[model samples]
Target: MADLPDNASQRRARAFLPALEDREFLRRDELRGLRFAMEYHKADLLLREWGVRSTIVVFGSARIPAPEAVEEMLAAASPGAARAKAERRARLAVWYERARAFARLASVRGGALTQRPDRIRDNVIATGGGPGIMEAANRGAADVGAPSIGFNIGLPHEQEPNPWSTPSLTFSFHYFAMRKMHLAMRANALVVFPGGFGTLDELFEILTLQQTGKAPTMPVVLFGRDYWQRVVRFEALVEEGMIDEGDLSLFDLVDTPEEGWESIRRRGLHAHTPLAEAPDATPRAVDAES
Candidate 1:
């Protein structure tokens, strides 16, 4: 057996370390609750420091490419399925440009270009912190010198945060639930583009929240009207009685960037302190589910 002196030294070394400094101890399953809270507060504290009062979230497929990149991609293709897919994406590339345009328009019109007297910035762009539409939105914000956020989540394949997002505002999370919370909590509006499983997941999550009254109402605009209708039979959901016809009113489909922005404005989207407009203390955070 090891001497008592050696055992005492081991205990002393570990005991001297601070709780936060003990990375191995922190990773234990028993410390998961603390980790969850840490994840929540890390982003929360940083966002508060930046005075980001609200955001316009942009969600879409990370596979989509900007129009200029399409020609290069097609040229590099091996032909057959790859070339066919490239051609398909070439058509979808229009949505990428439109996403960029809408983001710039929103950032400028929605007051992200300036901070108010309270030092809070509203209607700032926020994205999943990955490529495709996320990159485009962040790029748009950059075009006008406005800051945008990217809440990136660690994945099996390790998705990188897009370069277009403001460096200081970009964050990474290990837990998808924590990432989703941050995405929803501070969002003032959501502009969804044509996407696949991931995009659908984000879109429906927000819609469910709004449907159940778990979240405050905000503008929900889906770009690529023809694509979304083809992809989702929202009318079927109503017809089948899985959802009410009135629930269809929850979001609008638009084609152009101008139409998307106009739809948002027409749906009561505003640029200033939305939550702070009310004097109530409890409204800011009603509960964790929000």
Candidate 2:
């Protein structure tokens, strides 16, 4: 190699490496489309490989803590206003357990624990992969020893994915659109808890899809009736002709986790797993392919 001449001919003869191997080129601004494609395919391919054909998409507040964490905040507060705020959060904190319980119920009944003869899993819990409600949902799936997904996103502030989701199915995305797509792609039903701007964004995305007939009419449940009613005057949209009166039926309001799951069941979320079938039945009915 030392004997090689340092000349124009030698430089040209080197034969530059393929662009596919060029990490720097891939990171360039012009390759943004490729980056987006990569984000989508990574999650999509992995979800398929894991046999996840459908999911129960859960969306909720990241600020809200588990019940015990809120209790700790209550204990640490110095006085009046701080203590009052902590107490309020303590009330909302119950949602953490509710989300967890709901996820467990879905996973146990929704074929996530049992791969059918065709090897497809449905109603596998999928969350934003952050803490609070996301963590609670993922944790619930873990509780029942079922697989779950955590579609994490890159945020300006350092956000971490919860540990409860299956490692093979956990993913991180640089694009919110790609992350949202993954969340909505295979969603069999949606369960939303009390949350702020980000949660609202996701909720409306699916609502718009269903409203425009872009997505299937899946059951949607909005947990915490009081919070949702106080926060969103959905009736105003109907009265003002911004939306149809029936558009409000896109989601059901419920106060408890049991009520939330019941609404979905009533709305036609079929439990394809053996657990839901008749005990004395002979041959099981084949689960409909997704």
Candidate 3:
């Protein structure tokens, strides 16, 4: 451990260590001890810093796919640029529109909910702390001029906390498990965008936690119908008797930020009206069977 990098983030990741270790050569008890030591000692301070409550875990692709990037870039342009470009630049134009739309949604209501008068309890938007959709989500939260949290982990590529996160709340972790723990510890909901292996890992981990009675019943919403349908045949898996049909209800599919906001609002409002009891003060059962 002394030979490892001295930086806090790198030291936390044990970034010097290999991604895979074969335990076959070690005795079962020895392997267990090794795992315990690795998990228990890693990232203690980072996790402690994350604290509890008022958070959401958002996952998505960092790559931003070329077409999507072009769309975002063009859509951000002024009217003069829009008029000058030919129809061939349309993909960029669309992305620009989506980005602006996302920005607009983030700016209006995101901060208002956190205002002193509203007194919403234990709620913050949490993200993988990377680029792409993760950035978009945190950026949305920031648009409202409120603090947002980022749970970042060390990855070889396509992983870096976007500049939009609130400084005090940013956390970088070495252990994915610990990072996920923070995500679930106070997560009121999960909002997923399109991504690859990392995204699927997070999506399934949360499902497993809920399915196995590990976490409280929380909303999981997938954005972008086209991107989600292409990634996994989840419905097909359910149809083949791999999983119970009702399990499919664990998540909802939606296309817009308005719908995402509504989904979270519904859960937040489930136990109270605007003038009624506070949401968290009420006791709720952890019925994973849902």
Candidate 4:
């Protein structure tokens, strides 16, 4: 055969070269470790670029309905046991509303929307990017036109990002460890509404972090005194000597958004002097030594 054209030869040579731009190469099994590291770096860079100084992380059940939707949901359910379950869920609707209000309060007071170029964005509401209290908190931040974050994880059921999260700040992660790391890393405070397995897991993770001095102690507000008291019986843990009595001070039980905010303020926000010209917006590392 006649010699291949020079251009064709060059094209073949280029094709054989391992191009970093090749998606197939990036997806190869050998690149899995690199891919994992990239996931962490990508999120870290984006968060820093967005000036996310710190976040108020919110966790709760995805099943909770908006306050207005509770009545409709309860009415739609069949009578008897089904109706009773709905009624119980409906009673918890207040927590959804409270989460919303708490987020708004934090966003407004935490300098989320401040225009000062010197200010670091602080106390931006962060959530799991699913419905229920997550949507409520994101919606609350959106109510005041503040930026918020959603760290969504891919699952079998495929949780969708809530509509209210700032589109640029919403992130999806394939690794639960990475997702939880991002959630806990910059949290200035944690407000947990009544929830199931996921919420309990997250709550305990932060508590363990604080208990073991793995992370800086931040205000952990367990919203809904009655619900938490009945569900966890934390005092029992103390009495049973499963946890030290001092561990009880790691969290506060608050019934209302105002109380939650106050607890956070007193525990986490009190030391810093309030800024008159614009709050001290510098981004301090959550784990920075005191």
Candidate 5:
């Protein structure tokens, strides 16, 4: 074969040379571990830079519409089977309002809008970054002109981040585990509303961490006692010996937003202080699994 041309040698070098900056190379399956680490560190650094000491996580159904949307949905439904579904949705729509009110309470009380540069933001509202209760919670924080976090995840159906979340603080994740990690990492408390499988999964993840002593103890408020009682028989778990009776004490049941806020306040790691004072609080460790 004839000797390769000078240009051919340059082309071969370009093809074989490692390009660390190449997006396609970084996205390969072989680099998955690096991706995980990047996800963890990116969120960790952003939160720290924003001075988010701890979060108040809100978990609930994305299906629940806003209070105003409930009436619109009801009106749009046909008078037969669809009407029943619409009515049920309307009933649950109250939770959206409750979630919003609870978030506002937490943000205002937890010093989200405080001007004290010396204090880190505590109990900043955090959500799954979708519609429904997440939107309500973010909106509540925005109502008070406070910054909030939204940890959005990629899904087949394409869930969008709520507009009310602090635009700079919002994040998107491809890994469910990473998303969940960020959710619980700095959480000072959790307020759970009536939700479906996704909500239950997230609720139990935190419960398991608390039970195992892998995570710090924080208040977990289950909104709507009637709905939770109907859904989960915590007493049954005790009777069956699957969980200790003390496990029931891990979470409190509440009916209203005010009650939920009070429950969390009573159990929060830090005492309530005036917005003017610099809050003395420590960052909760992110190493739950450790």
Candidate 6:
């Protein structure tokens, strides 16, 4: 093993002795302690390296359960071993459908959700580092050879840093609040995709921020027109008079990548660099209490 740094606690048994710097033989336990501290501090450094600007946070379902085995067998195979064959076919079809759904979600008119300089230049893509839609967006950016970032979390399920991410940019967080912080910090725009509870959580957080003027200049774009319209009834809020008609204008519903790009660009709202560190990179999650 390489020799520990002179300041390493193990090497500097005097680390705890009032003096902060030391240059001596490192103790095993002290070395471990120093290493842990270094590892913990690396989170921010990694995030900074990832270039956290111009991000579009995309979320979507991972489990699009395949069709029933019997249905597949009936569609393809006949009697005897037909059931097994049919089931396999059905599963394959569902997988194909799931892949297609992700492909459409990843496709932004310009190209696949691979990394690209345009995302960095346009301030357009970022996400909660994982598979599904997040992977698609990062992949799309990578497709064009641009560094993409992912705020990956240590989750029991539904989380992993996608392969497309710029190596140093992948961040794993112990705190959900911290992970969410990185998501909204330098975000020039928020591009929401169809997802379950996590998607709803992120959507509301952004809405709350814009509605409260906390992230006033930031604009939100919702992808998947049909899904969004059916999922939430913003019109009801407007009609109820709880919010003004103008309030609904904070976010624009978009069906295509071109339209989504145009809306933000037309207004000049997403001009800021998405990765530049913000003065207020730390904000309480956007909710009534926050």
Model 3 per-residue lDDT at 66:
35
Clashing pairs in 4: 120-281
lDDT at 21 for candidate 1? 90
Compute the lDDT for candidate 5: 0.85
Candidate 6 local distance difference test against the native: 0.58
Candidate that scores best on TM-score: 1
lDDT (10s digit) by residue, model 3, range 141-225: 5654545667788777646778767666676766677677767776777777767798899899998887777888888878777
Tell me the TM-score of each prediction against the true structure: 0.89, 0.88, 0.63, 0.86, 0.88, 0.61
Better of 3 and 5 by TM-score: 5
Steric collisions counted per model: 0, 0, 11, 1, 0, 27
- Model 1 is weakest, by summed lDDT over 10 consecutive residues, at 281-290
Q: What are the clashing pairs of model 1?
A: none
- True-vs-predicted CA distance for residue 288, candidate 5, Å: 32
- List pairs with backbone clashes in candidate 2: none
What local distance difference test score does each model get? 0.86, 0.85, 0.60, 0.84, 0.85, 0.58
- Residues 1-290 of candidate 6: C-alpha lDDT, one tens digit per residue: 99765756665465465433443533355675564454456765654444333454555543322343335346666666766755544443433233223223323322222345643333535667776566666655554444456678787764767676666667777667767776787666677766678889988888888888887467677776787899899999999998889888888887666566666566455334233322222212222110
Candidate 4 all-Cα RMSD: 6.2
**C-alpha lDDT (0 to 100) for residue 266 of candidate 6:** 61
Q: Of 1 and 4, which scores higher on lDDT?
A: 1
TM-score-superior candidate, 4 or 6: 4
Between prediction 2 and prediction 6, the one with superior TM-score is 2
Residue 153, model 2: lDDT of: 92
Segments in model 2 whose C-alpha atoms lie over 4 Å from true places: 1-3, 6-21, 274-290
